[model samples]
Target: MSQLDAIYQLHPKRYRDKIEEESNYASIENQKQAVLSIGSLGVAICSLIIFLIPYSTTIRGVIAALALPIVYFSFPYIAISVAAERRRKEMERVLPDALLLISTNIKSGTSINRAFLASSREEFGPLEDELRTTAIEISGGKSVQEALDNLRKRVNSGLFQDTLKVLSDAIESGGNTAELLESSAEDIRTSLELREEVKSSIRMYTIFIVMAAVFGAPILFSITVYMAETTTQMWSQTDLSGEASSFASGGSTGLSFEQPDVNTDFLVQFSILALTITNFFASLIISQISNGNMKEGAKYIPFTVSISVGLFLAVKTLLGSFL
Candidate 1:
């Protein structure tokens, strides 16, 4: 067996099934091999970069090389999640319209199966595919409730699932299906509008957080660290032997000029680490405020970190040149 096949075989069945489900949502075929290829490429690039860094310690390189394999192996999963989220969002955007169309069909005396099939228009995107499948299942030997349950399971969206569950319950109770669908569509539209309003109201908070984490902290740390380093350098070059001797001779002014014990390298490393952590949490907070999901912020992590670090380096360089 090939290396990817070996890895896939070693992976747990549940995890493999989850990957397959996410892959289906992402419309990706043969995802196991794709994930393996992506992970291997990422690890190779990261390990090479770690090893090639100038003046990097052997221990650091070895540790990074060891850790990167595990970290980069998750990249494909992250990618799949992002793609699936895109699909979910597309379906969500068109859900209300689809439901309204289905309600219209139901009011015109069409069966639920036919209504769903008719609602599977091209503009509905992923929801179109799902509705068509559900209709097909209902037309076959499967019952309506079971087909709808399958539809809910196929979608990894809370809103979609909840809507389907309500529809299923209505079906079981023999309620007015057309009116129920119309009301559900109206509720979904109202919820989406409220979400937009909430986002608008919190726009300033998101801006403040992004600015502070990506711009303010980096600039401040760069200035303070550069000053500390400059102070250390200046103290190192100053002559303090005469001052020490005068103090030893019991001079009236007991003054001493000792070199600073601060390590500039440690300061720079700490600043970078602090900036990274700050940006990471800031991204999550922004995502939570805007999207209501912390994982949605993962896409912003790299962008925030890169911009903040780059700004920090630029500020440090500018200060060094000016001073």
Candidate 2:
């Protein structure tokens, strides 16, 4: 084979297959396309690193080689993370509008199917998209139940899925679909409102945490700094080297290894960083608890650590005159 043909043969769908392997691309339809998406991301990230590493030193080249795989995997990670975040924001924004739409339609005495169609026609972004898809499917010869199921499956939105499932069940049972839809909408609305109230309350918790990290830590740190300064003054004046070498025979002799000079500066810096990070994380956890989204809260761990530490040190230095 020619060189170009040989290269193609050797690397036949290499990146796509790697993605498939990583994803265990099975059971789900369209998985091959998803794998291809992963392939595109990995190639984009890795190729950039490879091109840049050519001009680097040997050690830098080695570092690039080591980091290449991580970057490749991280590309897909970034894609998934972004998609998930977008979907979450869309769901949250669409929910209240969708509920309001259902309530308005039911109050005006419209059938649920026609109400769903009307909601689709409205320009309320994400909910409109899902309703449009379901409407089109139902209009295109799909059964109402099947269309709802298909819409839920395609969107993979938890709230949307639950709403449709409840409506579908109610309709299938020959029960009052209108009542169920209105009741469900109101219930979801109440949940969203409760979440807002919780957020407001949690702000108070944040103030408590601020008191601990800001006021309490500084006071404690001041005491420690004073003690460190006291020790430094005594150590600086004493003949520590000669006293350091002397070992006593009795158990109470107290001669030990020569202690390193205390650097209050380092302690001050460290205390600031530690207290700040501690406070930041405390606030982040309070947010999670208030929001009722523990899973979402976990991702902010790194942010909380970085912000708290940075803020504490910065603030301490800024307020150094007061201390």
Candidate 3:
């Protein structure tokens, strides 16, 4: 057995026999999880090493320390996040081709398996492999319906899931498979085009989001820089050094009886840092919410935090002359 296959066999499933009876996929799930575990750990360690290192109190060290934690923590997240994203995009890219193939074969009056395998042999991109997997499971004594359902779950794209659900319903109801395949394929193509149309229609908002991310903050940053510099300059001009200087005319030295004892430079820098962190998480949280799954974007939080901090610090450093 493959290492991944072996690992999957270790899991104690509540419906092991039922799953085994329905599909062979459950038999190898443990191995897949084992690979994921190892991959996440490996990514985390590599990121830590690359982003963090032996350091002095130099500015590089400060930046490295600030950046390292986010990168380190996000490494594992990257693996999973990228996987989900990849699966989703892959499904979309290959879906049309799969649909076309299935539709054509069904029109030619082939059995579902032959149609699927014939379609599999074509370059349907990522879906080709998935089709091949489904063929394998069907060959392994599982129904084509069971294998396809499992594939849909693994993909988890709402549209794909809906399509698979429709297929399942058709199978249950003993409907016309060819007609269903043609309709589903046409529906998918229509949905994609409609989505593109909607997106193109609202291209303005995308620009606004980009503007908010890039140009909007710099204007505020310039204002903050001006304020911090003005405050620091004003404070520096006050003579706070002479407790008993010649200017202490009445023994109650005027130098320190009124001046605020806070470093405006440090205050502004700290405030900026805090704001950067807050903004990163806020953006990530909102994106996740918009996508209809908060957990989907949870892994990306650290990466967002890291990049935000980097940008924040870079701005601060460029304006460090004010300090």
Off by over 4 Å in 2: 1-97, 100-114, 121-123, 154-159, 210-234, 241-258, 261-284, 298-303, 315-323
Q: TM-score for each prediction?
A: 0.89, 0.57, 0.65
Specify the highest-TM-score model's number: 1
Candidate 2, which ten residues in sequence have the lowest lDDT sum?
20-29
RMSD of 2: 8.6
Worst 10 residues of 3 by lDDT: 18-27
Q: What is the lDDT of residue 254 in candidate 3?
A: 56
| Tens digit of per-residue lDDT, candidate 3, span 1-323 | 97766655664464334333322322234334534464456556644644543333485556656655555434434444445655576677678668777878978988776777778854566677777878778778898778888888666477888888888788778898777877888888898888768667666664564356444554466457666766667877877656446557766535543555566556555555565556565555554434444445555555555655556557666666554
Stronger candidate by TM-score (1 vs 2): 1
What digit string (tens of lDDT, one per residue) describes model 1 on residues 65-113?
A: 6778675656677778778888888988899999999999999999999
User: lDDT: which candidate is best?
Assistant: 1
Whose TM-score is higher: candidate 2's or candidate 3's?
Answer: 3
Worst 10 residues of 1 by lDDT: 47-56
